[model samples]
Target: MTDRTDETDDTHRPGDQPEQHRVTDGGVTAAPGREGAIPEEDTNVTEVFPEGNLDLRAGADNCYKCTTCDTSCPVAEVDEEFPGPKFQGPEQWRLKRKEDADIDGSIMSCSNCMRCDSACPSDVPLSQMHNEARGEYVDDQMDALSTEYVRNRILSNYRTSAELASKVPQLANFAMNFGPARWVMEKVLGVTKEREFPEFAEQTFREWWRERGGAHVQSSEKRIAYFHGCYSNYNTPEVAKAMVRVFEHFGYEILVPPQKCSGTPMFANGMLDDARRDAETNVENLASAIADGADVIASCTSCSLSLRQEYPELFDIDGVEDVSDNTFEAVEYLRIYEDLEGELADAELDGQSFGYHGPCHARNQGLHRQAVELFRDVDGVRVEDVGDSCSGISGTYGWKEEKYDTSMKIGEEMFEHMKHAEGEAGMTECPTCAMQMEHGTGYDIYHPLELLEDALVD
Candidate 1:
């Protein structure tokens, strides 16, 4: 509601300045404690002040707002509370995160979708804004609820995954049983009872890559390492496999090098410290790969977006900084296929009609049209674009029992769109959105590649 577009739109209550924020008790501005030295970060009594108008200046230099921004927004339509990044980034953040609220919750429900940036008419670098906001919050000690959740999930998933992997011989096969497993997690670990979490794959995408003799391509002219993120790494190895297939189809060798997370989840959830740790690990692991003529291609939208942008923010490690720019999402990478003649793999469902649900993170990376073009090239693929909007599943935010009804409610319109489409599946590039579509609408969801891979020659 608060528009920061106008330079003169600022309305500060009498006493606040750039130095210290004023606390208001009801209508009256409360005086500072004893020392009126308009506080700084070092002194802390938890001061409160109205947010300043933040101008992400995203309108021009931002990731152009595309239809996908609206499509992937979790609360765009249903909740009058949010008007999308156009509203939040330039308007709310101008004053709040820039001036008042902590960075973490300042952009609550954003889910780091970055879809807005993807769909931005002007291609605003929205992912950058959100990441920067979050970093600011962490530096300023922003709200830690999301960060707390992220920390717990990381530890919880790691431990639980190890335990589950211990019980199941093939982890990938066992991941299919996440339904019952998630229920158990609800009662035991208190991971929001309703949220759906992906089960860890028995074999990592990297492991699968090696088994497929991916290592033998050491001498290939085209070598692109795929950082499959945690979801694709542990649960949806199929997506990575599909990407590998596509890469091979183009005569490119796909590498599954040793790497940790991109740190978007950690930063978004307030695990600034933890996020830094993950970023550092990735930088160290990818050192050889990036330096050795390897290009990074990724399938997980969130992971791709994170590695391309957020990693530098978390640690500023020289290794990641050198190559993050070279990373590309599956869709981004596939565009090159378009530049050259390409064939569809999952062409079996080529004519099968479906709607495209871009994830916020993927949107941020600006890949909807590229993805749309990829499927459109297929004989049976017909994509009806849902345009800009959130899918209401802000990654794991939609997984909590308390957030279940709300998450689905936020995505109700998109759900209906998928339901009425008469398509064989609800297609999205995000794993979390796939989970949301299935859980929210009881519809089978497929990554665009899955639809194509099923049509493969082999």
Candidate 2:
């Protein structure tokens, strides 16, 4: 096993280059040491702004320093280095405009759970600011071609990795579990040895959809385009099947459109440019579905958040606004259509129970307990709200070597709750949360849709 310590790389700063420091993206300056000081005119820089040219200063003006965001932060609960969302968000926003405001390294610890955005009585987009600040911080600390940069770039492209892994799952899983392979990853890629990797499905959801006569399937006017995310499509195709069955059972035509990763991983990892590009692509792809009278739906809360919220808030994209209006979280969509609950009421779960782990992002969307409520409607099914808790696996954050321990620590309470719950299985909207729950508690986890599908009375 690798020797682990609580040490952080904060102290490793290059020699002072005050003259060379130049503010680039209105956030942070470049890294400390370089060959020669590059002039601003010589650099081909284009700062990507959010749609509506979102005024960060205007949003920052809403802060009254109530400490509400700080108190509500899940990351701050685990890591003290993170001074809380208030500091990283509005407070920093106010500070950054000052003539002499240093880049706060502590903001890097934020998982971007977005709980602070909900916690704010003033409704400050604190988490959004922190996310942008993180991108800037990453830009300031590392060069584009640095080892960490390359590693992050690869990790951010999880869809590509998943595609390859799904093609040869056994070999991929073996490579991940093998000691020497893990050692190489820890040493070279900065992924931790102890972290359990999610297994890839033998067949992708898209492949399964095609085999099941997806193109031939016809239905009523009610239609939905499923955004299965990377996990449901590649890691857990069964969830995708369950979602389709449940949707079809409720009398909706399911459209499985060609989709890409929602760029949550890229945003979380500070790859803003790539994330923006992904947002642009996804929004454009979703357009045809939206135009065909199909509302876009996603089972994964993070993916839904990206499609319905993040793209509009964090990236300048044309179709994002339209997509946001038409997009829905799977359960949230079902919750709105009360007749679906009536259909679920007839489903026989036979005393089946689930300890529902409401993901932070799902809660951030304000549809709290939608999954639990959906499960509760089934006959003989007992659903316990395991309390709103951060699963600590904020996309790729928990996969990194340095952040692994903190991730596990943040998840300890939720894991303990699952361990003691009456349910035999765990339920959650976010796939990464499911991965963390299964790893932490050694219990089989299911997407709420899977439970719903299983409960369906033929």
Candidate 3:
């Protein structure tokens, strides 16, 4: 396991880097990511800032030290060394990566948990910023490996979850019992092990959409082409169905466009190239939605986070790539159209208590808080704002043994909160957090939207 520790303390020296700290025993495996990759100046570099991604840079600069971001971060909660986005970026990556150097490798630890985005006081959108910063580290080869790995290693031979279960007992109940498997994957692969990955559902949302003839696209009115992120599309088809139902209640039409993975889960794994290619495909398909003036609404928080945030940074590196701009978190899109109650609306109280975990991408988008409010509006929803940032899952960061203990240690605050919360169950808008919370507390969790979909008045 890599001797990874959080290093973003307030007093971090300007010259410090993740690589700088890896020298304790006089020798270490020569830092894997940066050694072979040579920084070559190409059209891609020029594309990164065509007319220039000035707005992206400018947007990153906006922040006030409310510590809301630092305060709420799940990773920061555990790893005090990670100085939150406000510190890591505008403070670190943006300044360092531009040196045309290897600074991009240093941010590999972000985990993409996004607790800071939820807690940020200013409009920094730190979640998106760090995502972009991470994108800068990508190259084509990285993408190829993940595709090769998932296709060749896991998906092909591992015929069913049951087969995967033989290696890791938790994989048998992957949707629920993924923590231990993820823990092992992290130890061996450097991937975060804490994430509650979506089970490859017996049926997918796309298959369901096909059964319904790919839900008609209502071009005339303001519409949404809901991009069911990985989990919603695969394991949690009900989440996608529920979202469609939620939108339908308002007479909004949904077009199940031919979209695949948003690549965020892969991206979090540092499989940048695969993520970039996935971004390219998504951008092209989504252009039709943008052309129709429809906002690309997504229920999977990470996908929405990637589309609105990472796609632009990674795929648009040459500056000319066209990813649709009009994207919204499912809740963000629904919030504007539907009025939420001040308290839990129709949530089944039947002696039920609830814990609310916010997703990082949603938090960064300023929708995490709204998600909490949405649950609060539910009649029987008992909301405990656990207030921790990333849930230490950092997507799959918690799963890696190298970062495993740290990730769990990082998740301690939320673990304590969830343990103390008087809830019958836990719910998070972010899928990754739901997985992490479940592992930490052994409490069943659901996305708030599924709950909303069930409770909505037709």
Give all TM-scores, in the order shown.
0.70, 0.85, 0.68
Which scores higher on lDDT, 1 or 3? 1
Better of 2 and 3 by lDDT: 2
In candidate 3, what residue range of length 10 has the lowest lDDT sum? 1-10
Q: Candidate 1: TM-score?
A: 0.70
Model 3's alpha-carbon lDDT is: 0.61
Model 3, position 256: C-alpha lDDT score: 64
Each prediction's Cα lDDT score? 0.61, 0.79, 0.61
Ranking by lDDT: 2, 1, 3
The full ranking of all candidates by TM-score, starting with the best, is 2, 1, 3
Candidate that beats the other on TM-score, 2 or 3, i.e. the better one: 2
Question: Which candidate gets the maximum lDDT versus the true structure?
Answer: 2
- lDDT tens digits, residue span 132-162, model 3: 5565554422354653344322321222432
